[model samples]
Target: MANTAVRVRLTRGASEGDVAALKAWLERERKLEALRSSGELEIQERAGTQDGQGQARPMGAGLDIMLVLIGAAAPKLFDEVYEQVKSGVRAWRENRRDVENGEPPEVEVAPDGDGR
Candidate 1:
């Protein structure tokens, strides 16, 4: 089975707290747990930003999240989970009065080392 990596770039208006809550939700997500048990999912999180001087700053309003999956069925699994998560994120953002209307987070799938 091949391994695939999926990267999710959060929307610009998402606060650090939003990212934290999303991370926590993913941790306790039942679907993710099932994927973990089946040996098909691995998750990594990247929060904060780089300063103009190239310094790593503290957590901020935007973050990136990565997920690695293994198995022949990984692509399909990623799609399913991504849709569910994206929907949840949209709902979460809608409830927040601080965020402005704009493009939502984007998910990119990397297959064979080329991100598309």
Candidate 2:
């Protein structure tokens, strides 16, 4: 079976702790069991250097994650994954005063299209 993947990248708006929390939640949260058991969903973390941050931001890679959906997934599945991730991050940022501001860090999620 072929596998499609989506990369979820976060900016400095998310702290190291936040990244760890998100990874843990997505991996172990009971709420996500349905998605986990579907055989259509899989998650992974990748490590790499953060390039092009310029002078304003730091230059280092954060703990970014990827979501892999097996087989030919429907468009709605993408939305479902996006929402799940956003919800997870939102929950993590809720109580934190520093990141609870009007504008939180940016989360960019996009499909790589290369079914491995």
Clashes of each: 0, 0
Location of the lowest summed lDDT over 10 successive residues in candidate 2: 48-57
lDDT of 2 by residue, 78-113 (tens): 666666776776665564445455544565655555
- lDDT value, candidate 1, whole model: 0.56
After TM-score superposition, the amount by which residue 66's alpha carbon in candidate 2 deviates from its true location, in angstroms, is 0.7
Best by lDDT: 2
Cα deviation of 37, candidate 2, in Å: 2.2
Name the runs in model 1 displaced over 4 angstroms.
Answer: 1-3, 47-62, 94-116
Can you write out model 1's per-residue Cα lDDT over 1-116, one digit (the tens) per residue? 33365555555455665566666655566777688678887766765265333477445564655666776787677667666556655555464434645644332323322122
For each of the candidates, the C-alpha root-mean-square deviation to the true structure, in angstroms, is 6.2, 4.9
Q: Which pairs clash (backbone N, Cα, C closer than 3 Å) in model 1?
A: none
TM-score of each: 0.55, 0.62
Candidate 2: where are CA atoms >4 Å away? 1-3, 13-16, 28-31, 50-58, 74-76, 96-106, 114-116
lDDT of 2: 0.61
